[model samples]
Target: MNEPGYAIRAEQLTKRFGDFIAVNEITFDVKQGEIYGFLGANGAGKTTAIRMLIGLLSPSSGIATVAGFDVYKETENIKRNIGYMSQRFSLYEDLTVKENIRFYGGVYGLSSSEIRDKTDFLLKKLELEHARNMLISSLPLGWKQKLAFSIAVIHDPKIVFLDEPTGGVDPITRRQFWNLIYEASSKGVTVFVTTHYMDESEYCDRVSIMVDGRIAALDTPRGLKRIFHASSMDEVFLKLARPEKVGDI
Candidate 1:
């Protein structure tokens, strides 16, 4: 479990390339064991902000920390304590399910014995025992997503960054995937996720909506709905994303 207070913290976080600012000065705190939804449309800077938080991209200014490690100086340390699952379903299509698990474990510096043990555990936990030796390409999209997420947290990282982890899956699979997320949160893992799905945003403990590289709204789902005088998160998003359409709501 993380210490009391925030598992992730940012202070006036900003990122820029030349004269164009990709991520404006945004600040927020994500508590340990909480599911935080980072919502924004394409080109709204959600990805840039996530890259900075995970230490994939350096910020032009401001300070941030993940799992208690500084983004600038302790990027390696940060990577070791956090897991990542991208929307692209980052799994090798030719590798068998078991092989992929072992490969990721090795990448995280796990011993051979540890990799073997994790492979056994994940297969059972994710109910993939029947397909353990099957090539990833043969699995359905839902299975691939579950396997990708399982591999990401194989080492039990303190925090996990999920970049649109449920893009194209069906409703049933999405619900099942969220159950997995809830299970991880129950075990004290901070889940930082980014998505354009409005219903997905409602599942978060709190959400932040970005507009043109700036956080226009940051609050709990209920709080945001109440503040925006809307009926749902979708309405809140529409209101914030298109302020001129507030009257339409």
Candidate 2:
């Protein structure tokens, strides 16, 4: 049994697609209410690893649990206990802002009364009251991203998984998004996020870097910089993932 303080736990977790091993034996733990950043270049096996952690894809070997439920055996429970947002805002473009909230609330098993209360609260919380009846497609990208994240957590999940959630947003919007993450973390919601933005990695309590399907480094951003003798997460990543670049050296 995993310790009660852990939100995510993996032991020699691995994934293999036939002869191709996508994720080698990787082991790590994320504490309850912690913000953990998962970073990697494209095709570094981050997606495959996240799928296994969130119970979307089964691992060929090893073990993983999310929110205290086995990834393979308790996927439904894991899904229920977690919120997820991808790079593309998952909102329905055709649906009104409030409609989108209600629909997702329903999907998460929120009752009619609960959904109604949440919708009102979300509109005010996200400062979208005036846009509540507006179609999602009509909202600005930043607003849409914020709304998408708010809706994902309508059920008050224990953890939220953000897969490149800040992609394409302006710097100010990205900063606002990080503020939201900080607020969520302060409220005891563990945040598991993946991003290509090296600057974003600095915001995490701890970060794990994947290189060619393996975790080459995992630590606090400052600690990683010290270990790699680099000044920023960007330099650290380049050193770990692509040391051949003369500029990086």
Candidate 3:
């Protein structure tokens, strides 16, 4: 279940490899049930920040809390309370849909009966009932994306972190996948997503645009557009990303 207030909190989060700082001192918060988007160009430290938040990578410095547990000291607790789906699908290509779900559920400590029940519900909800027996490799790209997302949260995590969840899917399929995200948020699941697509960023309730490992902008889509004096998210991003400076636009 979600806590009463913030779902995620970060303070001066920093990550470094030798002299290369992958993520600088960045801070942000994600409210319970909110759709929070992390937007940036490739290698802008978006993935690095997410890895720290999800407990997969240790930060060189700074502090963070996910689902009320400290990221550095309470990583296991954070893992238990959150789900993650990376850009790489991460499903076993040879496994059938049902098998993949069962494996992931088991990893999350779900009982067989619970996995079965939840799998049935998810398959129906995703309209994948007919494909439940199909091998994951045989499924279409869009179906696999949706299935991966569903499996990521099958254990009923309070928060779900998606890193470029709809990367290469067609526009229509991407819209459908977003509908699923909306469904999850409506059910009180806080979604933390990262994407390069400015259009997708607009769908977020709030967005943080990262540049050179720092948050260059953070606000609602309308707020961003208003602040940047732009007509759309693309224009807003361009203005922030100009070589001159964030304020030059």
Candidate 4:
């Protein structure tokens, strides 16, 4: 059964590689339908923690759950309840837009009719009907990014994980991408995203900052600004995640 109110829960969740700890004991919970931002600098273990949470990597210690499925015991069920979009975008370049939608919809166990119906709806909603027959490779980066995200949640997953989804897009594209995110959130889909864009932090319902494989702060963007005594999320992130001067990793 799903957790009463939390979409994700972890108590002292940790991971280790040899003697080195990749994700030190971290505890947190994401409430249902919340936009939870996961932020960390390079080597801070945000990805490792996500890997363990999403069942790609086993945690070395502690307990965790996603969509009420135990990370240790119900990994397959967790996979079924969550959608994932990687930074590189997961569409096959050779596949037409319609083809990719059909492929992923089938992968999620939707029937032929369901896929067909959703494909039409998605194409129209994203204004991609004109491009539905075109190869994914021929689409602009923004189009591909939006298509990838739409495909990720085509099954209406309980949660969606976006890993640096807006990495190289222009400002307008990023704004458009976030509009989709807001629409999803309004529909009760939990969003767990990892991004370096400080401005994006303001959009999140709550944000967690990681430093040296440990979460140094977790709060609402406004709360974080107050706690860090800063004027913006950028200053808060810098104070907690970047203790060293520029040129330091």
Candidate 5:
């Protein structure tokens, strides 16, 4: 079993590249089944911090763990326990929807029989049974994103990392995508998502905002708004990221 307390825990985590710190010393914890939003602007180091937490990049110092596995010593174990969906949507455009599901299932070490069962369930759930034979490249962007999210958690991973999972989609599609996130969370899957969409941050249970390679604020959306004396996450970000532009908000 993993930790009895948190799905993910980081204490004073820092990542440095040469003399430049991409992720400054930061500390936070994600409880089991929580929807955590890692919010930041383009250069705010959200990706870098997430990379460290996901075991893609090594942290310079501090302590951290994912799914109860030490980040530095048990990365392989961590990898086995988590699913990742990248910003660009982790799907093969050339492959059919069913094919993509099968491939990822295998990569996640599911048996052939398990893959077959999951493929069928996924197709039915996404209402893509009719499109299973169609190439992913032919699908609409919204459908593709929904399918991508479904496949990410096909293996019942303990945690799923979504790096801007709802980018480039219409508001309705984004809302649908969040429904999937909520479904997964209901089943005890911790969701750690990184995105810059201020509107979407409202859907998260809690969010941490990064600014200039450091965590500027971390709180529930309502709590952050209260603390920053702002109306929304965007205004909160403006107050933290660009103090001089605070007047504009």
Candidate 6:
């Protein structure tokens, strides 16, 4: 059984696509109000695992609970308790910023008045009040990314999943996005994020590195560096990615 305080718990979670194994049996826990980073390279099964957690994809075998709801039985409860932002911006390109928020808020079942109030606050916080009426396609990439994140959490879910939220943006924009994530975490929103960028992993409270569909290591960034005897996550990743030598542990 999972402990009372964990926001997410998974035991031997596995996912298979026909003959190929996308995610091997992996187990981990994410605490409440934590910023947990899932780091892995392309084809490393990060997305497949995340999909299972968020109820987007069912696992082949295993037990998993997110926000205290079982992934297999109470998927609707999990969906209601969590928010998700994918790599592709989820907003409609033709809709204005405010309109996009309105649409998503409606889908989440928020009252019109509630949506309006939350939209106002988000626009101010994102400094997008001037562009509230601008079409989503007209906004800069950074602004779009920020807006997408804001909409994802507009209903104030207990947990939010960000999948490569800053994929192609500049360093400055990525830093700014991290600030938003930190703000959300401070407000007691648990953040579960996956990223290929090594530097971003440093911003997390704890990180899990996935290699070949399994979690190879899980620890705080500093602890991981100390254990691996590396100066940066890039080096740590390289060390883990290298082939094991003869007689190696």
What is candidate 1's lDDT per residue for 1-249, written digit by digit as tens? Answer: 245678899889999999999899999989999999999989999999999988889999998889888999999999999999987779999999999998999999999999999998889998999999999999999999988998999999999999999999999999989989999999999999999889989999999999999999999999999999989899999888988877665
Q: Model 4 — which ten-residue stretch has the worst lDDT?
A: 240-249
> What is the overall TM-score of model 5 with all chains considered together?
0.96
TM-score of each: 0.96, 0.97, 0.95, 0.96, 0.96, 0.96
Candidates 4 and 5 compared: the better one by lDDT is: 4
Off by over 4 Å in 5: 1-3, 247-249
Model 3 TM-score is: 0.95
Cα lDDT of model 3 by residue, 97-209, tens digit: 99999999999999999999999999999899998889999999999999999999898899999999999999999999999999999999999999988999889999999
Query: In model 2, where is the ten-residue run with the lowest total lDDT?
Result: 240-249
Query: What is the TM-score (0 to 1) of candidate 6?
Result: 0.96
- Model 3 poorest ten-residue lDDT run: 240-249
Q: What's the lDDT for candidate 5?
A: 0.91
| Reference-based lDDT, residue 203, model 2 | 98
Whole-model lDDT, model 1: 0.92
In Å, residue 204's CA in model 1 sits off its true spot by: 0.8
Query: What's the lDDT for candidate 2?
Result: 0.92
For candidate 6, the 10 contiguous residues with the lowest summed lDDT are 240-249
lDDT of 6 by residue, 117-217 (tens): 99999999999999989999999999999899999999999999999999899999999999999999999999999999999999999999999999989
lDDT of 6 at 111: 100
lDDT of 2 by residue, 77-140 (tens): 9999999997666999999998999899999999999999998888888888999899999999
